[model samples]
Target: MEVILARPRGFCAGVNRAINVVNKALEVYQPPVYVLHEIVHNTHVIRELEEKGAVFVEQLEDIPKGSIAIFSAHGVSQAVKERANELGLRTINATCPLVSKVHRRVSLLNKINYDVVVIGHKGHPEVEGTCGHASGSVHVVSSPDEVQCLQVNTPSRVGYVTQTTLSIDDTAEMLKALRRRFPEISAPSRTDICFATSNRQTAVRELSKAVDLILVVGSKNSSNSNRLREVAQKNNIPAHLIDHAGEIERGWLDKARRIGITAGASAPEHLVTELVAWLRENYKVRTVREMDGVDETICFQLPPI
Candidate 1:
């Protein structure tokens, strides 16, 4: 058996910055420092931080008044920030820069009297946060079918922004639907999908061609990670999104000679290391290799805690 790793897998610049902010808060603040949501989407990362005294909460009201609170990398609605202030919590914004850009774009659209359409899965923390930025009419649409059924107050005065972690191809199709319906709809100057997401999807597409089965190392709730699995499947290749090596069933490997491994932005590299080790010990895998792909050099600086 052989294992081929995807290049540019695992932690990206934004995830790195978000994780560091949590760690830095732990060092700088009192114990039980609160975080709004999973700092990233990986369970391992969240567990590690929880061990170090980070408290993850879904609602700001759960946090004690005047305590230190941190927002997740997915960003938060303006109302969330206001509520945090009402609670007298000293909050740190750990929102990824890319996500923050989307929020800003949405706010700008709302200011210009354009009804905003957020192209992402509904109920996602990022989507909720982005929607909060728009005090006016804002709608969430995930597919072309939703786009067909969408209704905006002013058809001519409409603008759109996407989740930073969406699939490039999927977003393109959604854009086509929006353009056909609202010919004068406005768009952001640059694409909202983050660079790390685009690179990982591109790498997985290339990796799928060389392997019999593909394993995406990421949590099930991770949007970008799920996209990776879909991208491989779109190529007629079997793909599984596993949180870690233990999730890999022995039977799933029985029919495959070549396996491809890739991790999501939030997943830790140690999980990937352990996964490869598991394959070697349990499956007697040999000839481990990493495919050539993008070398991500971009890094976001940690915000002052």
Candidate 2:
């Protein structure tokens, strides 16, 4: 069987920077390093870091006073930062700079007397953080249907931003619907979708069309990873979102002679290597054609340790 692997499929620069923040902090500060959330959404990465003395906590209250605490790359609400500060946790902001850019745009819009709308999943940490930027004006709408039903404080004066990780086509469709409904609506001068997300999805869209089945390696909670599977499924191709090779179902490959594989930004390369090796050893997989596409060198500097 032929397997097509997309180049630049895993570990985007933001994810790398976030993971490195935790790693470097642990190295410099020693054990008992506490992270406010999973540095990134990959299961293996979290397990590995946890083994190395990094403690993951969902709330600032769980961290000891006077200890260092990291905000995940997912970003956090203003309230979270305030609470962490109140608790005496030496806060390290590892939020992706791209995500922070969106926040800044929306903040500017709010400051200029515009009611803001956000295109993203409700309750996502990033969305919550973004909404916190404008509690008086910001609104969250996830779908075109929701946009149709949305009620803004003012009809003609509105702006919007989106989560860093969302399906590009889906968000475009929603944005189009919103624009159609509100002709005078204004949007950010820039796009909020991160570069890594756009590139990965673009690569996978092409990869999906060439293979009978596609595998997206990522945790279920990972928004970008889930969108990869949705992209493949939207093309009428069978797709699986799995954490590792063990999660792969042999039944899906019964009729497929070729498969495409890609991983989310938070996923590491080792899972991809292991999965491909498994297919090669047991499923007669051979002749991998590497589809190298985008070039990404984006990196964020960690806050001083």
Candidate 3:
């Protein structure tokens, strides 16, 4: 069996910054530093942080009064930040700068009296946080089909933003549909999907061409990771999204000569190495190569101390 790895697969700049935020908070703050959500979506990453004295909470009220609270990389609604302030929590925003950019775009649309149309899955934390930036009309649509039934005050006064972790192709189709329906609709000067999401998907697409099966290492709830699996499957290649090497099933590898391995933006590179080690131990892996892809040097600065 031959193994192909996707370059720029794990830990994008935002994820690195978010994780570093938590780690730095743990080092600077008192024990039990609280995080609004999973710092990023990987269980292993969260587990490691937990071992280092970080506590993950879903609600601001769950955190102790006057405790240090860090926002997740998915970002949070402005309301969450206000509530944390109300509770006297010392907050460090670990929101990915890219996600924050979307929030700012939504805020700008609201300021201009334009009804915002968010292209993302409803109820997703990022989508919810982004929509929260708009105090006026905001619509969330996951697909191009949803655009047909979307209601707005005026099609000409509408603007759109996207979840940072969305599939590039899916978002493009939705954008095309939106533009077709509302010729006057406006969008950010650049696409809202982050560099990491786009680069990883591109690498996976390249991997699919040379491999018989693809294994995506990421948690189920991780949006970018799930998108990687979807990108492969959409190409009619067999793919599986797993949280770790333990989830890999030998049966899935039957009749597979070449396998491609990639991880979601939030996943750790160590997981990929672990998966490769497992493959080498179990299968007659003859060659391991990394497909050439984008070289990501982007890094986000940590929140002020």
Candidate 4:
């Protein structure tokens, strides 16, 4: 058995920055640093941070007044910011710059009286945060079918932004439908899907051709992680999204000659290392190689603590 790892697979610039934000906060402040949501979606990352005294909370109200509250990399809505201020919490904005760009785009569109549309899964923290930026007509459409059912205030005056972690092909399909329905629709100058998400998916697309089965190491809730699995499945390759190696099913690997391994943006590289170790020990894997792909050099600056 052989294992092929995807290049640019784990810990993108934004995730790196976000994790550093939490770590820097821990260094500067006392224990119990409040985070609005999971700093990043990886289960292992969150567990480690929790061990270091980061408190993840769903609501701002749960945080004590005047305490330090750090926003997750997923970003937060304008209302969330206001509420945080109302509670007298010392807040640190750890939102990924790319996600913040989407917020600014939607906010500007709404200010200009354009009915905004967000291309993302409804109820996702990032999507909800992006939607919250728009006070006027805004809609969340996840599919090409949903685009047809959109009821914007003015169909002619619509603008759109997408979640940073969406599947590029899927987002393109939605964009096609949106353009057909609203001929004059406006869009950002650049694609909203972040560079890391695009690079990882492209790497997976390349991996699908070489491997019999793809194993994506990431938490189920990680959007970019899920997209990586989808990219493999779309290529007719069997794929599984697992948080770690323990979840791997022996039956799934029985017939595979070469296995592909990739981790999501938020997943730690050590998880991928452990996965390779497991395959080596149990499957008697003789070769482990990394596929040639993008060498991501981009790094986001960490927010001040």
Q: Is candidate 1 or candidate 3 better by lDDT?
A: 1
Residue 276, candidate 2: Cα error in Å is 0.7
| TM-score to true structure, per model | 0.98, 0.97, 0.99, 0.99
Model 1: residue 41 alpha-carbon error in angstroms: 0.8
lDDT of the candidates, in the order given:
0.93, 0.89, 0.92, 0.94
For residues 1-305, what per-residue lDDT tens digits would candidate 3 score against the true structure? Answer: 99999987999999999999988888887579999988899999999999999999988999999899999999998888899999999999999999999999999899889999999999888998888788889999998889999989987899999999999999889989999999999879998999899999999999999999999999999999999999999998999999999998889999999999999998999999999999999989999999898899888888895
**How do the residues 1-305 of candidate 2 rate in per-residue lDDT, one tens digit apiece?**
99999766999888999999999999998988999888899999999999999999987899999998999998887888888889888988888888888878778888888889899999888898888777468889999999888887788888889999999999999899989988898887778998889899999888877899999999998999999999999888899999999998889999888899999999999999999999988888769888969888777788788
Clashing pairs in 2: none
For candidate 1, the lDDT comes to: 0.93
- Poorest stretch of ten by lDDT in candidate 2: 129-138
Better of 3 and 4 by lDDT: 4
Off by over 4 Å in 3: none
Candidate 4 clashing pairs, residues 3+ apart or interchain:
none
The clash number for model 3 is 0
Task: Assess candidate 3 and give its lDDT.
Answer: 0.92
85-121 in candidate 1: lDDT tens per residue? 9889999999999999999988888898999999999
Ranking by lDDT: 4, 1, 3, 2
